[model samples]
Target: MNWLNLEHLLLDESPDRLLCQDPDLTLGQLRRQALCAAAGLQARGIRHLAIHLEDAGELAIALLAAWRAGVSVLLPADLQAETRERWNPQVDLWLSEQPGDTRLGQLYDAEPLPAARLDLDQCSLSLCTSGSSGEPKRIDKRLRQLDNEVRGLEQLWGAELGNACMIGSVAAQHIYGLLFRVLWPLCAGRQWVRRQLPFPEDLQRASLDYPAFAWVASPALLKRMGDNLDWPALSKVRRVFSSGGALPADAALSLQQRLGQWPCEIFGSSETGGIAWRQGETLWQAFAGVQLTQDAEGALQVCSPYLAPGHAEQTADAARFEADGRFELLGRLDRIVKLEEKRISLPSLEQALVNHAWISEARLGVVRENRAYLGALVVLSESGLHALRNLGRRALTETLRKHLSNHCEALALPRRWRLLRQLPLSDQGKLPQALVETLLAAPRGKAPEVLEHKVQDDGLQIELQVPPDLACFTGHFPRTPVLPGVTQVDWALELGQRLLELPPRFAGMEVLKFQQLVRPGDRLTLTLRFDAARSKLHFAYHNQHQAPCSSGRIVLQDSATETAHA
Candidate 1:
């Protein structure tokens, strides 16, 4: 079947066309539901609606109805309670599956389901930014722009897709997933799963059910899927699409080896729709109608048909172009910082670090002491982890420094580095700058260098490294500085309340004991157990050698009012 343009998605499609996952569902039924909701929205005069639905089928009907009603829609990154409150002022009402919502069936009042072609130019959609650079902000687009993007995608991959089902791990609220997971299949007259697969195991099972399918994935998920599952289950897949960020070279290679083809890596953002794509190569070929150029400092400027007319985007990403009209991506140009009066490119440095065999993922952040310097948070590969376990911290740090020095000038090297199991990405799969800065600090009012944080059903166990540069150590006995007992107690309460949902206010402490001197670079383990019935927290700290350093039990209160009496 030829692609039915979104403008005529309802008008042109046959009544019996399959809509989605439900075998009995038909285009006619979906059209009637959308029309009823459209009538309801018009009756209420809803200008804007913020919506979150767990079922993508209902979500699709809602989107169609809202657009037909000429109501703009806001899609939050998640259905979290805080997300709703934060975005409350921007919308008139929320159409959600959460508690206290009216029946979705109630809106299906239009029985005959009036037929009409979409005036896509008038329809608008708003989605959240991916939350990588900072807090996720709202990015608005006309329905026509989205229509154009999907049409472009269809032109590129429709033949290869050939009626395959759409199934994915990514959320539909973000732009990448919205286009590839939902809109593309809907506009192209293809079927899609009503819900996203939560894990690779789920993907494996789902793939076996569909005759032909496509997998929309994230780099983080692909990296984590390494060799543990039944790879043969995905042999029938037609295509795999990756976005949100670059798929690292090694991870991409690993996937190619397992899946028999490299994923079609998409490069774009919420602001810039589909710009270019690459597969098994470093260079990205621009989309059919996208014009790419560079700024004075090499930042990429895009004239993509995906945007509104006259909206040429100047992105922060740096790029290098070849004579053949293909371009290679350098990292973000916006992360330039001045360290000791020397300008350092954090992205460039991070790229250098990630290319090393020792690191799988690298994020560079600023650390402030008396002066500001660069610090790093990295995920080590199997080989790097092996080296760390055998040669210890000093040797690992030294080897990393030697590798980094080969790519950058001496002034651009990171002063401190911490290896982690993974990157600190949000639910939207973005790295928040504020979160990065928090991870790089061991300041006066914060917990010391966190080596490990493990969460279990009843409690949390934290591993800490006492840094020599900790602000509290300045005067605590400059010559013979030891970790303050007060700081240790506070950290226990802090970590306990976060991971265990302990009472909010401090009551008192008991059985406090200090058995060891915790000096610079000392490793300590803090284990916390919460007794919910009594509102009591028991904390134990142990040195690296598994000997007791500090032990205590702290009382907690539900509120400040209760604490005052205590």
Candidate 2:
């Protein structure tokens, strides 16, 4: 496919394509700088160069120059010694404008420069996968794939993204960020914000700066924004797109509530780009020209001319088809398990638990001692705790049991329960399976001061300490080792349970708050009190310095009929 030249394609529009943050690079300046860079690289005989850069303007220029020169380019994942070593032997050049340009210059000084020859069908770029499961894999792309992708996005986004200022919180090194924020905007003549990585504050700032800003980010960024209690009331954001990880249904609703009613959530992977998008919780219609095919095993398969030909890629996610060519996201195929001779999806159970008023987050996993039994770790809110304490532990567990009984059988009610103020989520907004196992392995006797027992007429008090020797501190940070919030919340609940022993069970928790970081060597105090007759549990937490940290309420179950009911 012969395409328009990069310089002509971009410069033909107008001299004034206003990027929100960057005042330095105008359309004309960008084109000139890219041509110069391309000429320089070609003169140095750097045909196959790999880039590890963060500057949006610089990357755009470099990529455009490489395309114009018909030289191959690779965008590796954020640099590591190992990645450098792997690409070093294979790459003829390393193109970067960082401080260490001289280092690369010294490596390849002898080779003769090549003439600049632009071609449409040449290998354009390669993007590395996220490497969540293993080593990062490289996916090569022709100019055609990118041309089709940008065209598809331009059409699919319609007016929502049309002429909207693209603001991205994710790094440009990744596929999702590169395609939606950089390449699509470049090819489709859309203006974009220059910031490559944006924090919650930066995102809000970008929205305020560019009244027409549309955020393109991953679910991890979205969850972080929601979990950050101090986030400003966002008003200027036009729309937000989420991918990279599964967008939690609750998270989508929360974003819509926080940022004015904006359509959000685009569902896709790096392999297929954006396959479909969800406005709210309801329906997900496939993007234009994307076709869904069911495999022999009843699993969903995809075939789109946008993807490479002669290959059928299967996905682990299952979907329920609707009459209008839309689909509902069912939990992953691997998440389904047989519990008590009944099929159960752990994700479905986890979602149901979090739906409770008292519970802020929950995780359900099947444990096998002699036979498999449902296990749960729950984090409660302040109001949830009050309701649980008022009704008493017996009544609280009974209510929860009956609530879960609607979807799951009697045997599916979690036999073993550990109360927590928050559940651990990975950097990608996924629950860590390995961390769950570690929490479950804690011995019953030494459940720590956090998880023991406390009873008081006025209220109960508890203390939690992040021991420096804990194994988790190592992985959290090698040098500046600290306690992760995941472990902090776990200790908070263990202490909460010890302080307020109620009927051997509790309704759950409510309004549980995490105000700040609790690192190793920081001692935290948990204080609790309750209306015994009314079964109300009120609690407060303070650090070793007596600095007030967080406080909440718990609903306790009355002992009268707790176990018998369960």
Candidate 3:
């Protein structure tokens, strides 16, 4: 098989063919801009550069320019201040599109330069991976490896998707987004969107303009799409690809029902390029020229042209090969933990919880409390929320425990629980284990003081004294600290459920207004009224002088169906 240098491959394409949307630039224009940028970078004597631009179009141009300048490219996972700080000492220059930063747009006036002849072994690209423990792991790849994968992608899907423009909901920084949204399209001569389609509404609107387009997205964005979308407009979508995490079967089925096609799910990591893909319920099929085998520990091992030549990469995932040469993935071997001398699979437990009718998503982790205990963070389904509202936290927790008791061992059940509106995902669309542990950490300072309590027919009334060392007040504001609005609302509902008869699940809120700010050492009165007939909870916070601090009416639903209807 013949391989082409990155610059040559990009410049060899048709000059007048469209390569990007949003501003709509042709291949010839992109080549000229990249060549000019290459001249600018070469003039600066920058041999190593970090590329963290947000625009896909700018990123492609910058990448080609850096390659032409013989500058090694380091792709940081994010442009956050801390991430940049960590990578600053290693790179010679920082390139970004953010305001006030060093931008490629400045190089537009420079003279176009010749493309560099980069050796396959000499050209290096650095990619970052968030490892199992949430630490960043840097992986270096040769240009040849990327060339092999892009060629494989074109060979597999090029004919079916002939000339389809690429649109993505994922960022171009990560490996998946980098390949599907940027590299594959660049090599295949297909136009791609410059900006990421962050919302379902954006996808619907873009579908109208580009009738033949392929969407590269993640499971997180696809699963949360509400029913209020314009399904008819989405019918124009030719293909959809999902990666970054497991796509729930129900979510895939729902997308197929609305969009007339199932999303093809790709499974791989930063260290290993594209490994396998599957359309719907079928077993994962390895990509062309990719070979899969089991290691001594039964973990999946991949040997492919896409990887470093003559070496195999071991994956954390456990899998079993089917008779038909496909593979079925078991949970990650590293995610299994021991609890009270019993080995428990965290993924299995989470899958069981998600199987419950009331649970939409679940994440399980082991937290330290004298000894290690299981903790769960869950997003409730409509029915689950209804159960929470009517039964309270204790009842809802117990109900879930009871449901798990039928299938899971006693020690495997989660000891603590937190109900959230949605799972906290990092910018890369991954759940950071450290963030989950922080949610279960015990408060450091003294709890708030409850001065007075009274029971009413509709609700309850209480007086609370804000402690100077309240945990929520810490790091909330540096100079003039005031109680956060979210904290106030959370306290009202938590205290109401504990002291009075308030619902457990959060449904909806209306007329929420914050008039005055509460500070440390302030005495505030809280009033909560439950309207069972209307399924609404009215709450208000007032200062010692009876001036309103905040007020809201929260609506409760009996089932997810009811929530959807309302």
lDDT of 3 by residue, 1-566 (tens): 12233547545556776788768887788788888998888888888899988889889889888887788999998788888888888898888877766888876666878745556677789998865455787889988888888888878887877777898899888889999988888877788888888777787677667758888988888887778787877777778989888887778999999988899999998889999999977589999888899888789998989788898999878898989889888778788888878888887788789989888888888888888888898877768766654455566778899989987898888888877656766535678776777776645343457867898776788988775435565556534456888888788777867876655677888899999988755779999988877778789999989999999987765556466787
Compare candidates 1 and 2 on TM-score and give the better one. 1
Error of 2 at 309 (Å): 2.9
Ranking by lDDT: 1, 3, 2
Q: Give the lowest summed-lDDT range of ten residues in model 1.
A: 467-476
- Candidate 3, backbone clash total: 4
* Candidate 1 ranges with C-alpha deviation above 4 Å: 22-24, 79-86, 100-103, 109-113, 442-566
Judged by lDDT against the true structure, how good is candidate 3? 0.80
Q: Name the best candidate (by TM-score).
A: 1
Q: Which order, best to worst by TM-score?
A: 1, 3, 2
- State every prediction's TM-score relative to the real structure: 0.78, 0.66, 0.77
Q: Which stretches of candidate 2 lie over 4 Å from their true place?
A: 1-16, 82-120, 133-135, 224-234, 335-345, 360-566
Per-residue lDDT tens digits of candidate 2, residues 1-566? 12233335434445556433465556665665566666667677778878766666667777776776567888887667788787777688766655654232233323322324345457478877655433567877776666667777766664565566788877777767787777777665566777654466667666665546678886767755755433344555556887666665666767777766644677776666667877875678888878897766556787765567655557767888988889987656666678767888877787787777866677777666788887777765555555543444345556677788887878888776655544555333446554565565553222233433355556655555444235564445644554565554445455545444554456777777766555544567766666667665666667777876666666667666676687
Per-residue accuracy of model 1 over 1-566 as CA lDDT, tens digit each: 45677888667468777868654567777888888898888777778888777666777788888888888999988777778788888888788777775446667765434768888889899988756686668888998899989989998999999989888788787788788877888877788888777577777877787888998888767767757687877767899888877687888898888889888999998899988999999999999999998899999999988998988999999999999999998888878888778788888888888878878888998987887878888887767765654465567778888888987778677787766667756434568766787888843334577866998676888888765335565456545666789988988988887767877988799999999877655678889999888888999999989999998989988876585776
Identify the superior model by lDDT, candidate 2 or candidate 3. 3
Let me know the TM-score candidate 2 reaches against the reference structure. Answer: 0.66
Clashes per candidate (backbone, < 3 Å):
0, 44, 4
